[model samples]
Target: MKAPPFEYHRPSSLDEALGLLAELDEAKILAGGQSLLPLMSLRLGRPEHVVDIGDLGILDSLVVEPDGSVRVGALVTHRQVETSAEVAAHAPLLHAAAPMIGHRPIRTRGTVCGSIAHADPAAEMPAVALACNAAITAVSSRAAREIAAADFFEGYLQTVIEPDEIVTRVQFGPWPRHRRGAVVEQSRRSGDYAIIGLACWLDIEDNTITDAALSFFGVSDTPIRVAEAEDVLRGQAPTQSTFSAAGRTAAGVLRPTSDIHASANYRRHLAAVLTERGLAKATAESGETR
Candidate 1:
């Protein structure tokens, strides 16, 4: 199906885009168009105006900050993050998670900020951002502000960003040398969306787990950090038993809804299995670095 009729505006500058957004009603920002276009074609989205920020030359940068965080601009594609040495060194989790996004063609066009703005519950970048403690920057004609990843997501395909505010950049960072992370997912196929996915991070010191972050996607309306499961891993040895316990704790607390692809109980089982697998991989990576 073709998308419904809508007026389109191609803004050449960020300020112009902001002005267009402020002046237009039911306006949608088009950065990468990986998610929005498809939804529009399916009649799921019916925006009256599409403010194309594609020509906004200012939003295409990927920079590493002085404090060790990687800032991904609104137009920085997943392929850029996948190939960036600065991102790989400073924010390894983002690097590790980049390649897992859909496929090469999708990565070539999909923007990190776009993904975060889209906030699909099954998307990898959102959960990765949550686990990395990333900060999202939102800008409007009136003011600019930063939103924590933990509070940015509200529900399935929902975020706290207002209609007039555009997400400019997302910063992922402060990855200490002692911190190790990994991402694992159980998809229907290689490039399909995950049936269940986990982004695991562990800070290990002297063969003991000092801190842990376990963020899961495809199990709820939003990517959730299971604090109860994380507490189970803290101060414990990075052992199979500990990981299994954490997995069980996460499964117990997760309340996933049934869908055509999977039942709620089946997803709970996947949650348990993937949690163990992801934590084990992260722990092994940490051990190797030590």
Candidate 2:
């Protein structure tokens, strides 16, 4: 298969990219070209113009902020992120989730922003972003603004970003000293897309859970975050009973669809099972037992 005929532009700067986006109709931004190029080659995405920002210096940063926030730019590849000491130290959950993405070759060229922009329900990055309460930075010729991760993803492959808007970076913060995080994903084979995945974190103090965050992907239209599950664990001792209860709560909120990989009921079951396993990892990492 071959991509449909389209004009290609490589912009030198963010402003130049924005101008091109604003002027071109049905133009698509090309980052690492991991996902987009495949869709294009399959004729699933036939844009009138292709704006490549891969050479833009402004969008290639990967820095750890003084305030404990990790800022990942749109042009930063997943391989770069996978080997980043700053990201590994400050955002271990993200680091763990990075390898779960496709394969080494795909990771070598897939940008983190591209994955987030794709907003696949089965993607690991979006779940990690939501769990971390990350802030997404988007820019356009008209304005620039930050959108909270919780609010950025609208549904499967959908976000609030306008056609002319480009996602610049995602910022996540306050990496706690006592942070215990884990990313769990189950797929048919290694590097395959997850059938169900979990990104979870817990902060423990004085032998009790001070805070907890749990997010699920591949089991719903969008990532699933059950506040009730977190509520059940907060201020409570980390125990199997509590984890079980939270898992059940999580399953109750899910409305997964049946697919060839797995049935809806099986997905629901995995949601509960994975939640327990994730909670166990969280508790153990936080210096507790269950």
Best by TM-score: 1
Q: Candidate 2, which segments miss by more than 4 Å at Cα?
A: 286-290
- Tens digits of per-residue lDDT, candidate 1, 1-290, equal 79999999998888888898889999999888999999999999999999988887788889988987788999999999999877878888788889999899999999999998999999999999999879999999999999999999998899999998999999886788788788999888888888889998999889899999999999989998999999999999989999999999999999988988789999999999998999888767643321
Could you tell me which residue pairs clash in candidate 1?
none
Error of 1 at 110 (Å): 0.7
TM-score of 2: 0.96
State the lDDT of candidate 2 residue by residue for 125-158, as single tens digits: 9999999989999999999999999998898799
lDDT of 2: 0.88
lDDT of 1 at 221: 93
**C-alpha lDDT of all candidate models, in order:** 0.90, 0.88
Query: For this target, which candidate reaches the highest lDDT against the unseen true structure?
Result: 1
